[model samples]
Target: MANRLTPQQQEFYRENGYLVVEGVLSREEALAYRDEMHALAERLRAQRTVNATWPSIRAKNPNVHIDHCHDVQFHSAMVSRLIVDERFTGLAEGILGPNVQLHHTKMFIKPPAKGAPFPMHQDYPYFPHEKHTMMAAIFYFDDCPIEKGCFRVIPGSHKLGPLEHQSPADHYLPEDKYRLEDALPLPGKAGDVIFFNYLTIHGSGQNESSEARTTLLVQMRDPTDCPTVQTHESRGQGMMLAGIDPNARIRPVWEKE
Candidate 1:
């Protein structure tokens, strides 16, 4: 099982801090996942009575957002089984090495019209991690176009280290002398997957299409960091991965003798 990355991809990741591994999934597979997502959304919708417009809705039923993510990791218990499949887990083993933990999973659903752009920041900043102790696998469940809020990343920016991000305007720390004029839009059809280092500075644009731009973001971390448990509802509640609770605390469930 050769997990060896192409020379170009290796260099791109090492130098720029990101690698866009394209076409990892087929259109059929993407559609299957998309359909599964819709079904889950229906289930969540049926489980509640509050309308989508009600502010109390999210406060009362946080699971609704998680269910509709289409990212798979947020709600489906099936993600653990799917990622363990050779197509994904093998790549993880190859890129991240043997010891790894599924740190977190999220879905970015940019619906038709202009959704808020994801603030530009490194993934590590949002959680407690020791430096660059993680890698991210961003999978596309639908064709991603610039108009539909595709991912935009600054190549070679990872080498610069974590930046100081600002509010109001989500710009980087120690603001780069050069603006993001050269940032690249990772374009791909449904099923494509992009592997990038956790330190990579990335964000998406406003959705400007009739359809949604949906993607799943799975982050794998070195077991040492022990990914912090996130209580924030929007941060997503995680499920068990490979018989282990990736976000588990030191103690076991309170039922112990």
Candidate 2:
């Protein structure tokens, strides 16, 4: 927690819209996180069929799956500790100012030879903040090379504002239609962390490697932010991660019968 990004690193994030840091965690810890996440994924996936409820599943192809868990932090204590750990919150604080709040926690499991491609998209469209302080931290629990479909991003795209996007609705924007001719791949070993802006244009290729890629994505924001739309109820709202929320106050809600 004491270790934070250097001034140069912060500048790099501001300029490039992303930063890949190595040794943020140990191999054992990363694998532990992966094991815990995969266990939950399998259990949840078995109970529901992407049909009867809120927990949704997005497919990359016939064999590939993009597993998403909205309230993943509460499922396991290990993951809960990792997300709020100062090692993560410190880095997020570097880019997002002093105060930061956790927006959502999700784990991505791309099985070998079947991982899907995430079309280029900006995350800001989903749960936007007026201050534009939202960002994400991708924690790698395994070695992810280009063959495993590592993250691809257009550097400095955060400053470009919202661009024209197509479906799967708000979250998945087509990369082919954007200025991604010079996009770069971010490959990392276990324990590495990649931080990027919410507005960054990013996507991933299909996994052609033999090993599955397991990663945890943690979304955060400054606490002063409010939802632009009703995409989310106050499910995990006002949960402070780092520093203090000056606007922390009680709000009333009416009972529905």
Candidate 3:
């Protein structure tokens, strides 16, 4: 009944590099978040009206994949407001330890059959950190059935370091020595959360169900870990919190002390 993670959960996370927790949020809360997210996406799409007639919108089509705003800091604030409970931070701190900082936040909405399988990759490979480990929490706002494309993680794969990925276009053939296999789609109900290490190699299967798969992902790291340039934007975008300015002058979020 303690709100903190149990010893067994801690062991699972440390050994397998991931832990699946369920029934954290209520179905009503999850539905509210889903409504808010849909509204946000609609707002973002409407804002493009000025450029609606533009060539890029006409050719490539802007409504393709909704990339949540590229600003990590802003996204964190948004998620904080949505979750709006200290239990989130408490759970994160329990696993990651105190002196932790928000690294990034993202929402992936795999709409029906349109959602494609994400490529298998390790997050740390792209992050500019010398540290080998970081932590992530995934909140499932809706049912995560295998047919709806739930996240899949390779057990005990974090210790193996980053592995090369086969192109999504080509079939992964065993004769070719491709080790990527179907990670068990965690059969889960609404409000389930999956906590994982950054080094954990995880991916999703195609969304074959009629319903959309919506989940929010939050990353946290110890304050001592280094920050990485996760996007192409410059530091002047004013997208980060005041303390999170990427310029040499501002203290990195992880370095807050």
User: In candidate 2, which residue ranges exceed 4 Å CA deviation?
Assistant: 49-60, 168-171, 179-182, 252-257
The C-alpha stretches of model 1 lying farther than 4 A from their native spots are 1-4, 45-74, 168-182, 226-257
Index of the highest-TM-score prediction: 2
Residue 96 CA error for candidate 1 (Å)? Answer: 1.4
Candidate 3 stretches with Cα past 4 Å from truth are: 48-67, 71-78, 82-84, 164-181, 228-250, 253-257
lDDT of 1: 0.60
**What is candidate 2's lDDT per residue for 12-122, written digit by digit as tens?**
998988999898998998988888878988888898733211111143235555566666777888887887788878878888878888777777887788766676788
Cα lDDT tens digits for candidate 3, 61-160: 4333422433233534445564335556556667766445555666666677655565455676445455654777888888888888788887887898
Candidate 2's TM-score: 0.88
Q: Determine which window of 10 residues in candidate 1 has minimal summed lDDT.
A: 49-58
For all candidates, what are the clash counts? 2, 0, 0
Screening candidate 1 with a backbone cut-off below 3 angstroms (N, C-alpha, C), the clashing residue pairs are 16-156, 164-173
Q: Can you write out model 1's per-residue Cα lDDT over 152-240, one digit (the tens) per residue?
A: 88787778776665532223333254233346788778888888876787766656788777677787755545435332223323322
Best by lDDT: 2
Assess every candidate by TM-score.
0.73, 0.88, 0.75
